[model samples]
Target chain A: MAVNTIHREPPEQSAYRGVRRVDHSPQIFNNQPARYYLMWLLLPAVLLLAAISLYPFVWLIYMSLHEVQLAPGKSDLWAGVDNFTRLFSDKSFARGWVTLFKYSALCLSVEISLGVLVAVILNNSRLEKLFITIFLMPMMMAPVVAGFLYMFLYNGTFGWYFWLLRSLGVLDGGTILGNKSWAMAGIVATDVWQWTPLIALITLAGLKRVPQEQLEANMVDGAGPLRNFFSVALPNLYPFLLIAILLRFMDNFRFIDTILIMTGGGPANATKILPTYLFDVSFKFFELGRGAAIAFTLLLLTILLGLILTKIFEDPTRKIKTDGMD
Target chain B: MTSVTIKDVWKYYGKTMAVKELNIEVRDNEFLCLLGPSGCGKSSTLRMLAGLEFISSGEVFFGDLKVNDIPPRDRDIAMVFENYALYPHKTVFENMANPLKLQRMNKTDIKERVVWAAQMLEIEELLQRKPVELSGGQKQRTAIGRAIVREPKVFLFDEPIAHLDAKLRSHMRGELKHLQRRLETTTVYVTHDQLEGMTMADRIAVMHEGVLQQLGTPGEIYNHPVNEFVAGFVGEPPMNFLDCRIEGAGDSASLVYDNMNLALGGEQSRILETKGAAREVRLGIRPDDLTIEMGTDHGLELSAKIFVTEPLGGDMLIEADFGQDRMTIKRKIAELGQPGDACGIAVNSEKLHVFDRDTGEAFF
Candidate 1:
């Protein structure tokens, strides 16, 4: 009875069953390795990057070896290593690197410490979202705009900050920008005001990623608030804090617009960091060759500093490992 | 060790009440399990005891000292969370030594205690490894080891073994029970698994929807559940409830369903008579208490067709379909029959449970 009731194909399907089968192998284009195809797909983006960034960088290196002339009739002269030699001999150029080192160190340390404090406080605050939004307003503004705003605030004649500082005995009579001793302090203050929020936001995101249960466990383990912060929260936040510091350090190394617009390396060149000094040598002094040499030196310095920072802070052991069982 | 008492404790998250007017006393060195389903306030009660959660009102006492305002660290209680809550960055020895370190204990003594705990938990070899290097059961053992190393006044467990696989969970259950017995600490364990509660707890406090359903020893909870929920919840296969109506008020009273009737026994009728058993009542019976016969040669016979049969090793669970209701009956595997077969069901009268339909309160 089972054999009689077995399923049988229709006459049309049975007739076509004997026909030859077509080959279904992939075509030649599809047979190639996936990475080979991906390389072809990414060629356009690579070329675009070279055109915009790599080509200009190469051209700048070439121009640094020669004395470039902007006039159409004047021929460019081979200066050899004269531009590089002049960068080291120039007193303002030497002072620019020193000034930048000091500024980057001071600004980064202050911003990181303050940012972590603010993030911790705000993380525990009831109005965290509202306060975070308010704190981030300065970072959203254009750097040139912030520079102009601080320039007005530092004006001795009608600026409210100047008047308040004078009333408070902080500044006796001189403008903060015009005074050689106070000019760098004013620039650092402006940079801190505009950039501290970025570090705080990054640290806050890291703080939120901390497993809440671990904090509660610490409480049960007899850890007070301060001990909990040091033993549990801080260890978990190490990677994020390091990343924030590295990014802030790199950004501050090349800092230019605020100081350029506000001080213009003025007041006896007290605020002339590397980037501003390069601007002065290239545009103000019309010495493009020496400016390019300084730019290249700054790039090398940044790479060296970045490598050192990464080596010190980018240890993968900083991450808290979990068994992934949970 | 000290006794813990919760008096009129209410926990509220904003306006929503998570635990309502709870009162329980845990004697010194007693193992008490707060048993419930999810969102049933058992964890909240345990957390309140641990001082991890704030009490909205009322007082928690640790041997006459009110601890409503005391922080968790000062409360002298250790907790094992469901996720094991081991510090990922710390090794097992460090995790176990943390509490002692907080108390400014010397390195030698902290190491001694941690080693002792690790040995007791059979995790001495894992002491050098971090939590990330341990498996689920090993991590749980470390968590327990950490708790024991503190020698706190009380131990709170929030479903600590709920994440383990079945075999490992059962194995760890025995280990935890034996360990608690040895330590003699006042322990409050929370779990949604009834088996864990029944097997481990000296006294089981069953809760439902933020209210305590019943609190008794395992035997008492199983045999004399105060309400329908407790009866249904405390059992493995759960109690079967059949809707019926009471007919004839006096000695001739019987429970009647569609075309079927069961005479009320003397004790049950007397209790129902005094309680004024409403016209409608639910017949609650455990699957194990129901006897199945191949044919009708029994007292209070229920004609039913077998819906399905699940062979559970020694015992077979059969779903029997009556006129409009289905009930589960446990039978010996050797006596099991196929589905669609007609069978006679004889309910054990002494084990029968009757609840008022409206209030769901068990009468007998």
Candidate 2:
């Protein structure tokens, strides 16, 4: 064989490390001609989702701009932003927003504190199964039924809870559901009774997922049980707690069945949350146009809050970031 | 610093006996390694010392203080877990500072101590990073830094480096040994790797099946393993065993196996005369002691056919079929043929170890 010697220097190890900034570029389908076929295949599902969600949303916006007439064969009147503009001066419209936040706050504070306390207690208790079953009983009951049940318990005339609270000197004189100052709390109490277990359940699951090694390591690092919970367990449960709060917060806005059944926005409208007001406007008085306007604002706020929640979830500093390491 | 004494320690989870009568006295400033396979009670023993597990019976002490009922936090001991167990949410600095903060130390002092530990572990740059951002070696170092930052009376390590890769594990062995020496705190380390035990431990307690096989220094464990299990466990290539009979006594004492009758050395004959009760004993010898003599007849320690040969760069290992048992011989020279080649082997009889056939207890 003929002698042939040639040398080509090899690339340095660092030269092809594959570390470079990634810029966004669309590379979905390399086959340009087949891309249309893929899009055509995807069209049915996209249109189905649009029909269910987007069509109704567009109708709501359209209804918000017109005075929706319910009469048979009657033409609807176009009311250019009047229904929306009227909301600025409406006393009940502004109060509804304030009351909604108030109710949510009252419900969240009591639910989170009591739920976490119950979860922590039940976590190590031998009778946890029995107690969790008992606690979840309230959650399983229909919200309207739970509301009526609490209403009876809060009735000043013959209610057992009112009599007990009066005797204990905690209630003083106010009938829980009838009194103005206490009605919001009464509605909040009903919501808490029906939902606190959900928080507890979520927190319990979070507690289980908290790394046992971290707890043991903290103990070995000279933390007592209480300190270990705060130091390690609590941080691990932060994401769970956030999720629980978000669920409960949104539920507070959506589910007014218990509130409407128990309070009916009575006692000077102390518990007239936005949903209750919307319920009365859209259903009781049939002010569909005004209701649609209010509903749009409510939907906007919900979306905004959801965005805030997503931001919190994405916050790098507070995240318990054991991603691929596990 | 304190001396950790585990006296008659036994651990039981329900009916399963994890540790049985493990007695070890780790002196102040000493690095004692509990070496065993998984589920061999090494980790259980370490946990008992750290007060993480309840001892079913007996007592554990840090110096004169009985710590049987003391909780881990109150035991004044620090432990590094096998999985690193660095708090994922906290930065490396906070994780290292946690124990001192629990002590209610001043902010400046906690910062100072944590910084010192960070520097020692070479994790200063990673102090602000959370555990999730760290590589495995970095996380291991952070865990070690967290343990050392406390400067507790006794340090308990439960196979802390077993998660690291081979290169990092070897590198950490030296770093950990030096750290223990510099800190001069009593450390009880648990590891299943005998290499780690032999290389880093001041004294090693070898456990098998939840029972202490032998307790000795590296030299003693290597040169004079008290049982066949210890002899078989402590070495890299591991020791080989063959069933044989000890014939006669004193100068005439010989190991009778297969077609060969090999006379025992003077020192071995004396030890056998004093210790051997039954004539049957298991002949134990390391692969390093047996030399391969290619195409030879004289000084043949039983003829065997080469079953396989593994030629490592520096040394080659030759496995031979000696009667019923396969014997491995490691040598440096490469003047050996392929598999199935006939070879004579010479045994350095002085390096031979004899064990009881029934109980596996060493005769010497």
Candidate 3:
């Protein structure tokens, strides 16, 4: 596919003949657009990709429009916009969306703030290499495994975190995953502990790329070390932070492993986020059509969020102008 | 604004010494250029002066106060970096006004000062644009404007125009020198280009291998280099050196080489006689000093075959073979020669330089 974009003529005889610049603009033949030969060659792979991604999406829409059959050889019943219409009246679906946002917001805010702070401190520390490796250990653990680990820590019987919280008079002897007030915090803590390091790692990479000359220039311009970070380093880190946030947001819409393991949507559906609710509707009640409807809405929201983020990315104020990047 | 003195300063990054026992005093309101090739410690010396890097074991006095321990923020200095490190997020106006804002200057004053600098640099239209939107020359101008707006005590420019295109570089060189003169701030400019140093600096300090080779006016450094490195590093197409033996008995000393026997001028011959007895020495001459003509001319002591002729429009550079050494002669392109063609070379008598062959020290 990439080969189609390259000018097919010999490089020395091409437009950049004398100057030695590698001109990668698409080849145009006789003042007309060039044919994409490589695209035809990649048709098989493209078809396979379409089957994997497109087929399921089409099946989802189809399933969302009908009462899907559970047993083999059973005919499905048609439901005309009934499933989507029912979603407006269902309180659990509404609560699930609100809870999903609350959960994601809680996790993202804590992760981004704490992770960036950790990254800043660890960037040039004496033990930077050692600490980076140590901090990344949490991200290496499987989410399901981390959930089980945290479950033990949140246990009312012998959990050390529970004991610490109780002794500190912050918990009032309530188990983190059992109480309504603490269950949301419990999953958020678990997510933060498992994924905050990923944000830190991305931020650290961005921190490494913050122009050294810019920092030195700022120093000479009469800014202290702290002000230097605020003025120069933070602005450079914005794109990286935005990418990290979007990645985590997308991940939030998909990941239900830890929540399923730790809370199972909680004692009274108090911790039921949309993904957890969708899992119950799809797997527990076998309401495949309703679940498909819910899943489609979640997918739509994600796409919408992605588009908005892309709009923000393309905003001129945030984009640093670069030369010959295309 | 103030005289800056670097006294016996040395910089060691880990175990490697970048600048070794360097001493230089940039006079009040004088433009001093630290000139050298890459890894020659000129940038490191400038950085130490700007208080960006710590001096290993010496004093850097800004007037009377030793600024060795002071940070760059407190040093009251502005530096234009090689890459023109303007803030990517900020507009040119904001970038220029940053220093004034750091001083907590009033908004109206900051805006006025920035506008004034923008007009001086002829970048008033570009002030609203970010660094990325600007061309290489525009970015360089913005970087210069940022430094000039502050009116700091000293300005340290680290090859600020190095990244510009050839035409813009020459243009900026003149403008930068003019700006420095008008501002009358003590400026330490570092560049590897000899042209920049010769054309812009009041005094050029030629450095090589972490050592100060010579500190003199451009003419002095160009004509009477203290050593071979300064002579070679400070000229375009560089000074060509020929290995020869000094073989005269008394006041008449002549450099002898195969196919080349050149008599030294009376003044240089007398200086050589005062120095020591006859010995082997290397003769140095600038490309402009050596004359090359087609065919043989018997009166010219040295005759050699032409290697190549490169015509650079109005001028010509002819590389001629003097036994094992090749010498380039720069002259107008009125005469032309082909490769392997015989040519006569004439050495302008007074411009000849003889160096101690072993030590590479200048004899005259």
Candidate 4:
């Protein structure tokens, strides 16, 4: 094969030529389209959850504005703040609010105290896992099932606990749940029993995550047990304690299924909390508008409580950060 | 500053022995480094000194007082950990001031000490920052400052600079050495890196498999290692050992290899004759001492085919093969031959180390 060779004189280049060049845009999406397509598929599931969970909240706000009369497929009428006006004047609604505040105070105090005690005990022991499992058993039970379980255990004649309490001189001859004076106490006790485990569990996890090095450093610094707990352990546990308060606050308002089943709005509404009152107004008294209004109010209260806790948890270093080396 | 003495110390984990009969004395104002690989009982020994781990046997004395049963806080010792272990929630000032504050010191005194330590560590500007906001080096400085402000009798450092980058680690190593010298506190520093031990330690205690192998100054350990372990462990590019047999007779004893024979050095001649005929011996030579050439010297020369060359700035590491066996040799990268080239490697006669092949004990 002969090698072909050609030679030609080169063309002279222009000094300042402007050429319109095709901007063959870089294929920025160079990878397989399937990867991006798979990511886009997750958006719908997320949106679906937002729609199902968030839509009802919007609807509840809307319902709060209108007067709803529920009598088997009846349409609600637009009464515009009339239900809310009636709620302020109503003594039972006021009583419900008062009772809720009192109950929350009692439940929050007892649960947190009992929870921290349990956590401390668990933290300093080898039997931690065993005690934690035993303590968390009540919390793991469904609220409705837990309510029924307590109902049987607190029943007057047939209940084993009632008999045990009577024998121990902590109770009188008659049933305690039926007495109006003792009704709220029983509810508070049940809440503490069922939910204290949750606080202990959270606090225990917090305690476990506290740096071993920090503790050792403190011990090396000559901090006694009380001083270390106050200065180091307590400050570190602030975030977990904040979480426990917010959780217990939310759960206390939703104490519907348990309190409703156990007390049925109680002897003369003494133990009627916001949720139970909401249930009674809408379903029993057929005042759906007022009930939706009350529910919205409870939601607002819960949101306010959440905001307060968020503020606390959001700025652990706020005091220190603001002081700036003082 | 206080002197520490560990006498026949033993530590056990259930039935397994963690530290076996360890005995060492830290002279007042001396910096002693416990050097070993992981699971070598170095950390355990330090923790026992810190009173973090209980000694299963024997007594540990700080000054004239036996501290075997004293709690860590009452022991009046300070420690810096690998992670820098500062309180993340506390400001740098508070972190440094913590130990002093724990003693219920006056507010003014605490501030003065913390500021003093921060200034010494060149971290005065970082006092307002939290430990989380600080860099790794800054956090480590704060930790050291915390320990320094305590002014304890003894300072225990548990691989404090192991987490830093290479350049920074060297810088901090020098800082630590200078700081310890200034303080003149008896310090027990634990490290797995022999470089840190060599650079910072007044004396290094080499440990292996939960036993103290040798204790001496860094130079002594490097030049006169007691056994195969210490010899192999102390150097950067570890010493290489070759299995050989003694042959010939009388005053003309020589080491015979598969393809070569190396005449024994003058100092080794008597020991070589005592070893007798056909005795197995291991010949050790540091990489820096092995000379590479195209021709033989008075020592045995072996032909090796270069497989790879790693140029490390001034020096080059060559991995070469002698038949089926491979060995690494360090030489000046500029004068090094490329891979696949044939080169003759000669061990410096005066630097050759011989050990009993079975027992692995250096003969001369």
Best by DockQ: 3
Q: Which whole-number lDDT from 0 to 100 does residue B351 have in model 1?
A: 87
For candidate 2, what's the TM-score of chain A, rounded to 2 decimals?
Answer: 0.83
Alpha-carbon shift of residue B341 in model 1 (angstroms): 3.7
What are the runs in model 2 whose C-alpha is more than 4 Å off?
A1-45, A172-174, A313-326, B294-299
Candidate number achieving the greatest lDDT relative to the actual structure:
3
Task: For candidate 1, list the clashing residue pairs, or say none.
Answer: none
lDDT of predicted model 3:
0.88
Q: Using lDDT as the measure, name the better of candidate 2 and candidate 3.
A: 3
In model 3, residue pairs whose N, Cα or C atoms come closer than 3 Å (at least 3 residues apart or on different chains), thus clashing, are none
lDDT ranking, high to low: 3, 2, 1, 4
Candidate 3 docking band: acceptable
- Best-matching candidate per TM-score: 3
Over B256-280, each residue of candidate 1 has an lDDT whose tens digit, in order, gives 8776688887777878999998889
Model 3 residue A143 CA deviation (Å) reads 1.4
Candidate number with the higher TM-score (1 or 3): 3
Give the residue spans of candidate 4 off by over 4 A. A1-40, A72-74, A152-175, A178-181, A233-239, A267-269, A315-326, B248-252, B271-278, B295-300
Q: Give per-residue CA lDDT, model 2, range A22-48, as digits (tens).
A: 678777857545456888899999999
Model 3, residue A135: distance off in Å is: 2.6
**Fnat for each predicted structure, in order:** 0.36, 0.46, 0.52, 0.36
List model 1 lDDT by residue over A38-60, tens digit each: 88999999999999999989989
Question: Which ten-residue region of model 1 chain B has the weakest summed lDDT?
Answer: B292-301
Give a tens-digit lDDT track for model 4, residues A78-193.
98988788888988888888888888999999998889888987896999889988997898888888888888888997877777887899786467688787778877888888
> Per-residue lDDT for B263-357 in model 2, tens only?
78787888777875479999898999997877646358688888999888789999988777899898896686678888887677888999999
